[model samples]
Target: MNYKRLLFCLFTGFTVATSPAFAFQELQPSDDYIQVSKEIVEILEGTHYNKPSINDQISELAFEDYLDALDPTKSFFLQNDINALSVYKKRFDDAIKSGDTQVAYTIYNLYLKRVEERLTDLENNLSAMLEGFDYTLDESLDLDSEHYTWAKNKQEQDETWRKRLKNRALTLKLNGETPEAISEVLTSRFKNQLKRIHQTDAVDVYQIFVNSITAALDPHSSYFAPRASETFNINMSLSLEGIGAVLQMEDDYTKVVRLIPGGPASAKGELSPNDKIVGVAQEGKEMINVVGMRLDDVVDMIRGERGTTVTLEIIPSKGTGQTSKRIKIVREKVKLEDQSAKKEIVEVTRGDDTYKVGVIELPTFYSDFAAQQAGDKNYKSSTKDTKKLIEELRKEGIVALILDLRNNGGGSLQEANSLTGLFIPSGPTVQIQDQNGRITPLGDRDPKIAYSGPLAVLTNRMSASASEIVAGALQDYGRALILGGQTFGKGTVQALQEVDKGQLKITQAKFYRVSGETTQHKGVVPDIIFPSVFDTEKVGESSLDRPLPWDKIHETRYPIYWDMPSLFPILEPRHQARMAKDPDFIALNDQIAEFRENEDKYKTLSLNENTRIQINEETEKRELDRENARRAALGLEAIESVDDIEPTDKLVYSKEAAEILLDFIAINQLAEREKAQQEQAN
Candidate 1:
């Protein structure tokens, strides 16, 4: 239910079925895979949070999901293939339970055949199409084929392939590649795709089949192949020496989903979320086009020894065009120095008085578990680092503090509890509900309060899991003002169990805040909400299908440190007035509105070359105008063109949140002075 878990699901490689046996030889599922399938089913039915019955309905859904997994774009398999595989739709549950995976293997074999046939067709047709393709034609292709039925026959499949190939060629042409270059690239990309397809073995198919079953139970529940399990561990540990960006496969493209806060990519500030990596090259090596490479293979290519350089060709997520840029980065370990909690001081001028507010940016709730096990007294952790930062800030004469947890996809539940202990006296931080409906409270064991000053917690849509736990606990205790958009709402707990040669990541429990609110589908709502570009319907847990619902439990008794709810009414109007006059805030709102509008307009693209070019130009111009407007409002010079604007020039909503923290500091100071005056009178 966390971002890493989602990435694991996307990045885990799976194979699809091809046609009947003539095109390519069929590989049958091994006895080992069959045995593992049986074990997986037993575990899911017995211990999974849902405890779902493997009935006919579930089997039928799994069957359909398996088909979709194989031919998601409906590019390879024909209607005849679907018909041939339909016989197993109602019998998958029985087969899985009995350790009879013949049907699954049969489907996989068919898929392999279809892929072989498609590759042959593509190779045969590429030369002629590349030689005589007309770019100026007023033609378009519906790239989103989810609603379309499977191709009725081979002729229909051929037509679909032709359109798809033409679209690919047009995309390259739009990017200014020469015809000869386009031909070579397309030929190589297709050949590599075929080679990867051939590399899919029986274990890969077994993982895919079992995942289809687990995915039916819930989106978070999955079966990771042995190698995939290793990938999952690396993702969770964040100790690997690499670029420090989370990669996932989307529509055959490896995408940069997130950049770890202190990683090389984040430090360089060149890579961004949703940017597609089409090609990767080693230091002083020829670039390899990774368009259709397996996620594991691509990861291997990106990862290397520390202090090594890797270059990436990135297709920007913006607009409907295929423009790309290259970025080179030196790999480094995601060390404590990069991921550990960091501190800064911001001086705010209110009328004549200057107030210093300390800001602590927590990238993750991380801890050196190995170091602790090794009995190192200096083991690094979020709580320890945060405590030290607070002490340093206190010595520097700070009035208030802000715990910035933006984009922190959480880690270590123990760290979340200990981090909450840093602010408040002993109390329950979060509660866990297991599969049998047993609720267990996880409280802050440490009685020491690290800092008791006025506090605010900053969050965004990406603030998830342990981040939600910490923010929700602090808010529930009335110890800190929660500021920003709602958190990511990932409340479920997953446990990885080794089954035979693979791992089963099953959802075993759910998380609840001390105040009895579940941070599942509905994440923690900030006391003071800020403007965000993320669409809740598209980005949060609520957007996911079959997510655990939001619920409540009995509230725990904890003493409130401050009456924040009572103070919000007085602060809301003042904050609104400030935002209305602030140029940066105004620009942020305008940009958010424009973003929403563009999202709606570009849901389906005009594939015609001229129309696509025009749309891209318009989008670029609009973005440029918005950036210039923001710069002018901030008393900075406006750039004449979009190309002149650097990546760091992009507007950040956190600056507005920081300003709010300053307001909070000033108001709290005024209240404390008034209280002192009253005490003197008494």
Candidate 2:
């Protein structure tokens, strides 16, 4: 039988039954939901970059994705219940395509019932479970839900919940909460979750279901319900006030996607991409657990008036997610000027000579398009600002320049093209390939160069999109030495398309460099690698599910300014030797190595209270020792504890970049002199 036709037959005349008595509410799909689902499918099929076929394979993938979205931790829905719903697994494709979402509602209703039953059991037996926990016993709870199968029965699920509750209690106890305080916090958290359950509506269910299907296509693509669309619009209009971090639901946690450049979180330099926000608290209020809360509700709790404070308890992505840290940020309107490119000059001593290097830190590739379109000559743009800064640096007699693009989560594409033009004399900067297979090369048509002296482009894992374009173009043209870690690899282009009710953000194009290398999953590799504070597995586009693959196309014709490849042999060995001796770099490498070692151990948490405490202490001790070691090497006073160490305000990365620039200038100048001597001899 044809997969599509079979799916059609399966959903034809299929109606969802009313939710069980224990459910929070009798949730059902609305009339507009059907229209919206159909519209989403049509848009995805006709316009999406992949142009995937609607079939049983897609149906199965979407069904699994939906189940994971509903109960990522596998805490609800027994194996028997899953077996009962397995009949509709291959029918989602037709149901979504034909505007029949009864199957989706059916699954969601069952999930709600399972949730109520689990929460009810946990609430009724909370005291008994707490009292029964034996902290000395050698027991543990596997937090990685993928390793779990659905519980065979209610009894099995109860045992799982018992271990979970025990682990939660142990974590709280280790954090200095007394038994009484722990009980109160747990009770309040459970009650809040129960209240939120009752508030679930049809739109929320529809949004999740449709998004699950879209996620099967690509991680960046998603469906936004009407309410969500409104919020998205408000944020885009720059009218919403908050910490300025973009967040998304990752399993049962709200993971930070990217910190908006110049936002409170970005400016504070504490919160970053891939950090899981597990708890939220208002100013002077007790922390509220948000581990399993809806993304919308969490956002509401985090949102507040400007000048207010919101505290977030986050599991840092750089470390194993076994421990968490709190970060407090004051809410503010993210001003456009705050994200603009700025310039500074760093003086580095190399043996007997001191070299002056100009540094430009671009938080984002931004342009005042509204002002520019209205014929405002003084309109703010990254390229214009950078050009002016370059002229000023040249006037000051700087010998080298470094463009710092770390944590620059991209903005205007045109600005990226124009910025790349600053270093090269007219060349193709980037290439765009649309879904229809048309390749468009975007470049700097102007034959003028701003500053063509020794240059380096510094990037990190957070640098993405427009940042990748600029870095990749300059590297391809041999115009600059690319430094730092691999970029964030967000090369796919997304656009918001209007549906019947809300909107669909779909991936429609891909970005490529002049050398024909696509920047989709394999972002631009730096000429010299730096020790990254970010874990690549936890960050970047490759870390996402169903990400587009990296490929290559025909390379565009472009001119190379300097032969960077020939100089790498001379520069790389020096960089490696210097980094090997630098105490700060040594400490960073050791810290990252320790983080990798503990990654496996943190996958499963110890239910034994004593063991958990020991593990946490070991982590803290290692961190303190590393910090002290680095301080001692730098001739600074060692701190007694990690808490006593203040956040260093120094620009270590910029300083290292300046040193690298000095090496490049000396090497290139010596080569030029030797070439002139050879010509004279000839």
Instruction: Identify the candidate with maximal lDDT.
Output: 2
Clash-forming residue pairs, model 2: none
Candidate models: Cα lDDT each: 0.80, 0.85
What lDDT tens digits, residue by residue, belong to model 2 across residues 1-682? 3343345335543223442356476566688777777778889999999998877998999999999999888889888778777888898998888887778877886687778877887888888888988899998788775588899999999899888888778778877889998898888878888788789888888888888789889999988889999988987866679999889887789989888888999888788677899899999999999988999999999889999999999887766455678989999988888888899999888789777899999999888889999999999998999899889989988998999998898888989988888788787889999999999999998989998788899999989999999999989888899999999999999999998888999999999999999988989999998888677877889988889999999999998878898988988898888879888788878877887777777788877766776777787788899889889999999888776755442366787888888888888789899999999999
lDDT of 2 at 143: 70
Itemize residue pairs with steric clashes in candidate 1.
17-111, 18-110, 18-111, 18-112, 18-114, 19-110, 19-114
Instruction: For model 2, give the 10-residue run with minimal summed lDDT.
Output: 11-20
Residue range 109-216, candidate 1, lDDT tens digits: 667777887887788789997776666777666645445678998888777777778877777787788888888888888888888888888777877788778767
Winning model by TM-score: 2
User: What TM-score, to 2 decimals, does candidate 1 have?
Assistant: 0.91
TM-score, model 2 to reference: 0.95
Once superposed on the true structure, which residue ranges of model 1 sit more than 4 Å away at CA?
Answer: 1-23, 143-148, 154-156, 284-286, 640-654, 665-682
